[model samples]
Target: MFSEDPGARIEEVFRRIQEERMAGLPFINPALSVAAVGFARHGADWRGVLLTPWGIQLLLLPAVADWPVPPLLTRAFRQYPAGTFAFLPNHEKELGDYLACPLISDMHPFADQQTALATARACLIALDIPPVRSEAQPAAPASDGRRRFLGLDG
Candidate 1:
């Protein structure tokens, strides 16, 4: 059962997790709060970054109600415009079945929430950009006489 406001639902779920399970953890950043960043419909799912006290993650929730749930702890690969990413299937009673790909597993390095949010946004933008592919090209003969004299020509 996907909520009408998935971002708010996600925040609520994590905030509760933080209170019940993650309190007093050394890796939890005090400056960060549970937030869903840049959530929008991507293909058949809602894709976004989720910032929590413990880490930042890229989450994919079903846009439609009939989405099938994968077995818990199973790994799933999702194709974005940029590349393929491996996600772990998870289910929350509040958010239902979703896929999570951890972008940052440690929140200790983030000095403030703003920085973490910015990084999350950047990750979302990066997912839409195709990776650059490098191709090998034959080297051209050195045109400069100085290069030939110095034996620098390839």
Candidate 2:
């Protein structure tokens, strides 16, 4: 169910989580979901992103993580572990739309094909992945005539 390609893995994870959310499953941490979006956009480098319930709750509120904990709190409550959060990266501009109005309440933010495809394209662009032209010719002729019959000659 997994792929060796980093981009493919990230995309798969994002789609699976989206499906679970749409089905009303009690899976996917909000922070993880957002982080997954970032990974799906940015690729393998951001795979380490994660979000604890406490961390997300604190971030949503007006209160700062240090307000109560100070030095006593060993962990950085607002800060995600390493690459767990996507907002920390420089690709904020590419993801600003999604980040600004995320599906904080909606279960299937990415269930819409248009939204998912656009987001994936944005991610690939952010990661400098070149777009493959659908009109590009195949290197060899197909042995089967189905493609020609279907008029998908390219």
Candidate 3:
């Protein structure tokens, strides 16, 4: 299992999902949700790279306004002028060091939650991340006498 290698596991997950997608299988929601959770969980390890409905946002924790821009961000800016959130890692006098700052200067609003999630998923694909199997759905509600206490017995 790729889980054994935390660093590479994320990529493996994205690759599998992308492969399945190319094969013409129906797209699944939970698969992308899992990817989002993974990104949320491990984003810091990847230099705070983040996905949003509008585009990618590089969150600079303990912000440095004058942070040196990386080539990846420069390209992202060109590709998504209103979408790239950028902050180059630098040490020339700390700026905006008190808070985490979004790098994108402009953004297009998502139509809704679903749209945002879908875009996030696409961003993962664009970035070459693989998806993993979905987690088990929550258990069904109990159907015993206790239902009356919860007002569901009506």
Candidate with the greatest TM-score versus the true structure: 1
Residue 20 deviation, candidate 3, in Å? 42
Residue-wise lDDT of candidate 2 within 13-118, one digit each (tens)? 4455456533444543333333232332122122222222111111111122222222321332222221121122111222211121111233244444345445
Model 2, residue 21: what's the lDDT?
A: 39
Question: How far does residue 33 in candidate 3 sit from its true spot (Å)?
Answer: 16
Worst 10-residue stretch by lDDT in candidate 1? Answer: 142-151
Ordering by TM-score:
1, 3, 2
lDDT of each: 0.78, 0.28, 0.32
Q: Which stretches of candidate 3 lie over 4 Å from their true place?
A: 1-37, 40-44, 47-55, 58-87, 90-106, 129-154
Looking at model 2, how many pairs of residues clash?
3
lDDT by residue for model 3 (50-69), tens: 43322333333322234334
What's the ranking of the predictions by lDDT, best on top? 1, 3, 2
RMSD for each model, in Å, please?
11.1, 17.4, 19.4
CA lDDT of 110 in candidate 2? Answer: 48
Give lDDT tens digits, candidate 1, residues 44-130: 688899999898889999988786667878777776656567778898887778999887878888999899999889888877765
Clashes of each: 0, 3, 10
Scored against the true structure, residue 127 in model 2 reaches a CA lDDT of 28
lDDT of 1 at 54: 93
Show the colliding residue pairs in model 3.
13-130, 13-131, 14-129, 14-130, 14-131, 15-130, 68-88, 85-103, 85-104, 86-103
Query: Pairing residues by index, what is the TM-score of model 2?
Result: 0.22
Best by lDDT: 1
